[model samples]
Target: MANLAAVVGIGQTKYTTKRGDVSIAGLVREAAANALEDAGLGWDDIEAVIIGKAPDMFEGVIMPEIYLTDALGCNGKPMLRVHTAGSVGGSTALVAASHVQSGTFKRVLTVAFEKQSESNAMWALSTPQPFSVHLNAGAGGYFAPIIREYMRRSEAPYDVGIKVAVKDRLHGARNPLAHLQKPDITLQEVEESFMLWDPLRFLEACPSSDGACAMVIASEDLAEQSPKPPAWIRGVAMRSEPTMYAGREEVSPQAGRDCAADVYQQAGITDPRRDLDCAEVYVPFSWYEPMWLENLGFAAEGEGWKLTMEGATSLDEGGDIPWNPSGGVLCSNPIGASGMIRFAEAARQVRGDAGAHQVEGAKLALGHAYGGGAQFFSMWVVGSEKS
Candidate 1:
């Protein structure tokens, strides 16, 4: 086991389709600087650095970390890069936490970013590969079929995806940093939106944006010395399965189920719905809200759809387990940074500083992410009280 670690600071840039105002290096520094400022420190305070993002093709940059050294104030510090498909953001954070938990570093800086404006992620993903049928469509086309399978398996209504789209978009309006701020988005509008993929409407899908997220992870001693409440890292876990296997279940990946179970067990949770106050999960597509509910054990199989139908996951007036109060991946998806945003937002929730989307009296929260054909998974449990 590793030593206790806590998130001391979190930060992000205003997410949008294009951040032409800054270069890739500048984008990451902007977020890192914000986190450092929140932690009441500077570059010197961080003992090491870890950064993550999608493939370099997404930004037309080859191994960005190599050139971002000075930009991130890592000129002479140990810097590492992490990649795990879309889960890279959360994985990066977990790696930084490991440094502090292992007693190898007292404080570590972790950042994840994506500048998709430089290129096209969907095109990069849809590029033909050997032994693959070239549907020639982007991610929406790839995921739409799996979503259809979920609908059939759970017998979910068509409105389920629309409801989630509306809910998360509304939530985005409350988040100043989210890419999309559609406060007036309505379910009917989402239903009528053009379909990108069968059963997957445009509004139901996540946006491609440019953004970055950063966090300062520190040991318990350093966290206790800080003025702000520390988001204690109670548990952290990551798992992966083959991208495609004969018996694999993409809609409800076993890796996702196992990841949640491992984190819950480590955090002393038996009932996720009640034990955790809220969850910031990776839901790039609207239907994933219910799909993840089943995968993460928030609801029983074939019953996750009812939760969305009843508004249990709504931050506006939901119960203890509201999901993605920050609007989730649907609102702000900077591919590499999406998972880190979820992780950071979860920390913000437990820290009681999520602003408009804050869950009332939230003390404990969960952050989850999955990627690469829903094969890679990462999750963590955070709490307000130090232990």
Candidate 2:
């Protein structure tokens, strides 16, 4: 059995379209330093380090973690690099936690980053892969038709995407670290914005950003030494399925369903809607909010959009189950770091450190991420208590 592990610290740099002020190493260091500061620890306190990011082509740097070791203070310590497409960040954290859970380490440091200004992400993502369709419109192009399929099957309102765009942008305004903060954003603007993908407007798409996120995971004994309350990790899980196959439901993939089911079961959650206090889900595109809701079993198939229309996912006082109170991928998507942001945000909430976006009395929370044709999934549940 795995021993207890807790996320005792989280830190992130100010996300933006371009972080010209810092080098890739500097960007990674900034986030790692902040997390160390939050944990009240120094470089010597860390037992190991794990770093993750997207393809080396995205930043034109090969095995960045090797160079980032000095910046992240991993000298002479075990360091691992993880690349699981966009889900790398969350996966990185899970790998770090595994160290503590296995009784192999007392404390672990994990970081993920993306310096999009170094290279063009769109150009990298759009490159034609062997045996894949050559439409080459980038990720949005690939996911848009899938989104359209969800719309057709669900019969959701035309404004559902607009509503999510408005909600998340407004939430982003409150999070100073977010890249896009449109507090005054409205449904009308999103509805009128130029359409990039059919049924997906420009305002609804996640920005290509340069940013980093870091966290410190520790054993139970070490966790109790933290100055701030620890966000105990109740359960962590990952799942993957073949990228393409006949009759696969990309809209609600079985891998995603299985991932969520496994995590919730690990957390002993029988009724997610009523049991969990809040959730931070990966929503790179506005429509994904509802699509993931069904995949995660938070709402029934073809009815997830109804929850959005009714404001059930709002951060406002009107909603009970606040989703993405930190604005989520729709706000500050540093591709490689987006997934960990969701995971870290969930830990922040349970630790009562969410600041303005804090969900009051959120004893338990969920963090989720998916990547690569929506086939790879990663998730975790965190809570205030050790249990």
Residue 386 of model 1, lDDT score: 58
lDDT of each: 0.91, 0.91
What TM-score fits each model? 0.98, 0.98
Write candidate 2's Cα lDDT for 1-387 as tens digits: 889999988989999999888999999999999999999998999999999898899988889877888898888999999989878888888988999999999999999898888878889988887896776688898899999999999999889999999988877888999999798898899999999999899999998899999999999999998998999999899999988899888999999899889989989998888999999999999999999889899899999998888898998646878899999999998888899999999999999999888888999999988889898889999999977
lDDT of 1 at 148: 93
Tens digits of per-residue lDDT for model 1, 1-387: 879999999989999999999999899999999998888888888989999998888877888889999999998899999999989999999998999999999999999999988878877777788897886777777789999999998989889999999999988889999999999998889999998898999999999899999999999999998767889999999999998889888889999999999999989989999899999999999999999999999999989989998999997756557999999999999999999999999999999989988888888999988888899999999999754
For residue 214, model 1's alpha carbon misses the true position, in angstroms, by 0.2
Q: Which residue pairs show backbone clashes in model 2?
A: none
- Residue 46 of model 2: what lDDT? 96
Looking at model 1, residue 189 earns an lDDT score of 94
* RMSD each, Å: 1.0, 0.9
